[model samples]
Target: MVKTKVITIASVSGGGKTAVTEELRKRLSTSEALYFDEYDFEGAPDDLVKWVEEGPDYNQWNLEPLKADLESFLEREEPPAYIIIDYPFSYKNDKLKDFIDLSIYIATPLDIAMARRILREHLKKTSIEINDELDYYLKFGRVAYLEMENAIKLNSDFIVAGTLKVIDIVDAILNKIETL
Candidate 1:
């Protein structure tokens, strides 16, 4: 059996990972798509800054389920030909790094990333809730993103600008897959 191709798209918060992942999903109709943020919550304390600074892992999201899901899919007689995961933290997760066939990072400036996060929060969360989350991003998210950005950049096969035309990245991936 041909093994499944796993593509991980990593980026800092609000760095266009979801938007690009959506486009990839539309284009890769046969592939499976995983959204990390869907599992981003685990009922942790409301204070995210303290959570991060006080020895709590910033990436507290449950990923073992996603790993298990991927394993079960791969075990199937007919698994998806490709799997696309919109996730970050390749440098922090050994298992994630091992699972990736292709790694892509959506590069965005920190200022733009934080701005997008604020905009996204305004659309989704209550003002009071958004303030707390924004505080977390400002206090902890920036440091974490910088660390992740540097590590994943060294580990990625392609680093594309978040503002780049999607067709270009999609075409690039498709072309590479054809060669492989």
Candidate 2:
């Protein structure tokens, strides 16, 4: 039996991973794209906002749960021919890394991400206070960017831009998968 192919689009908070993943979902006729943010939380008292604020480590507190849920989902459904996950995958999760067939890292410059965050805060009418939560995310973003660079060094595919063109990245990954 052929194993299902899983493609993950991962990056920092404002790296356009969702945009790329959504475009990939639309472009691929046979694939089902899953957004980790939309996954059910199963009555967890704290919401994502709380999780982002109080989590011990980014992966242990936030990303690990998502990875576990995703792994369970994959096992239960066994999914469509191709599965694309739109989430930031921390390098700490080796099990999650092992499950993916291809990982695409989307990277934008730190300055660009900061600008995007400011714009997002303004649009949402939220305070621009640099609290622990903001600091944690900022640090995570920096670490994620560095990890993505290492992933590229390890031959993972990547797209770097303030504004990414998803179609091009999706097409390239699809073509590579077809040839493999």
TM-scores for every predicted model: 0.75, 0.63
Question: Which portions of model 2 miss their true places by more than 4 Å?
Answer: 39-78, 124-163
Report the poorest 10 consecutive residues by lDDT, candidate 1: 40-49
Overlapping backbone residue pairs in candidate 1 total 0
Colliding pairs, model 1: none
lDDT of 2 by residue, 24-120 (tens): 7777666777786786534443544444445323334334566665666567654566778885653334546676777776666666666666676
Position 167, candidate 2: lDDT: 71
Off by over 4 Å in 1: 40-62, 124-140
The superposed Cα distance between candidate 1 and the true structure at residue 49, in angstroms, equals 5.6
lDDT of 1 by residue, 1-180 (tens): 677888888888778777777778778757888887776445434764455456555345446767887787778878988888888765356546678888888788777888887886678778788888778776666666766566666667878876666677666666666765
Candidate 2 structure, TM-score to reference: 0.63
In order, the Cα lDDT scores of the candidates are 0.73, 0.61
**What lDDT does model 2 reach?**
0.61
